[model samples]
Target: MMSKEDKIYLELEDREFPFSYTDHDRKIVRAIVFDEEKKFYFVRIHRDDSFGKATLIETSGGGVEKGEDLETAIQRELKEELGAEVEILQEIGIVSDYYNHVHRHNINHYFLCKVRSFGEKNLMPYEIRDFHMESLKLSYEEAIREYEKCSNTKLGRLIAQREVPVLEEVKKMLLIN
Candidate 1:
């Protein structure tokens, strides 16, 4: 069994909603995806009032389908969201966050990934219509700013809480190696 120090676990509460519990769990895979230039790739989403009418930058990922391994799910999410083939350099750890308004808990598995190549994106219809999802590439400082800027929205706050620490961890790892 792994000790507490061996894993990075984050638990996030839903302060924006009055709901007190989560009824379902979602297993997800996300990446801090970078290219040879050291710029990171993310998804910029323009959402409506479901969360709020705001634009947000988020790590490119989604729910891991049944029977899909974490590696395969991350690979597929990158292909569909960013049109890039990535090399999974490291498994960062997990973030346990709640979407109380939706009654769902997210078990987010994060990875440090490097882009290998690019191709056409095959986005789902809902992702295109509902999220207005688009790919964004940003430097470390720019990404930090984007996260802070986007935190004006409810969903953005949750995303920033979940991702920013992981981003910092990845920075330290890169500096060490």
Candidate 2:
């Protein structure tokens, strides 16, 4: 069995809305992806609607599919988002956050992964037209700066709050500057 200290846990409130009900819980698998050269990989999403116009940087991940284990889910997510084959280096931890507007309680499972190769992305039609998703590769400092800069938006603030801590833990695990 794993010890408590082996992972970090976070509970985030819904800062955007004051809804008292969470109708559903979404179990997601995310990765802090890095290459042999030490560059990190993330997804940059551009939105221009109810959440407002903003470009947000976030880890690559999605909801865990039915009957899939966390490891399988993460590998599939990285492939779909980053278009890269990866080796999961470690399980970073879990972050439980609420999106009151959507009534979603997200239980995010984070992993540290090393890229093995890159290929074409299998992006969904909506991901292309709606989110305008693109891959971003940056050094540790650059990634942190991007996350901070993106925090100006409401959705961005929530994402930053959820992801930045996980990124910091990965940095410590990788011994990166």
Candidate topping TM-score: 2
- The residue-by-residue lDDT of candidate 2 on 72-161, one tens digit each, is 999888889889999998888889998887889999988889999999899889899999999999999999999999988889899999
**Model 2 Cα shift for residue 103 (angstroms):** 0.9
Best by lDDT: 2
| Candidate 2: stretches off by over 4 Å | 1-5
**TM-score for candidate 2, residues paired by index:** 0.95
RMSD of 1: 2.3
Root-mean-square deviation (CA) per prediction: 2.3, 2.2
Report the C-alpha lDDT of model 1 over 141-162, residue by residue, as the tens digit.
8899999999997888988999
TM-score of each: 0.94, 0.95
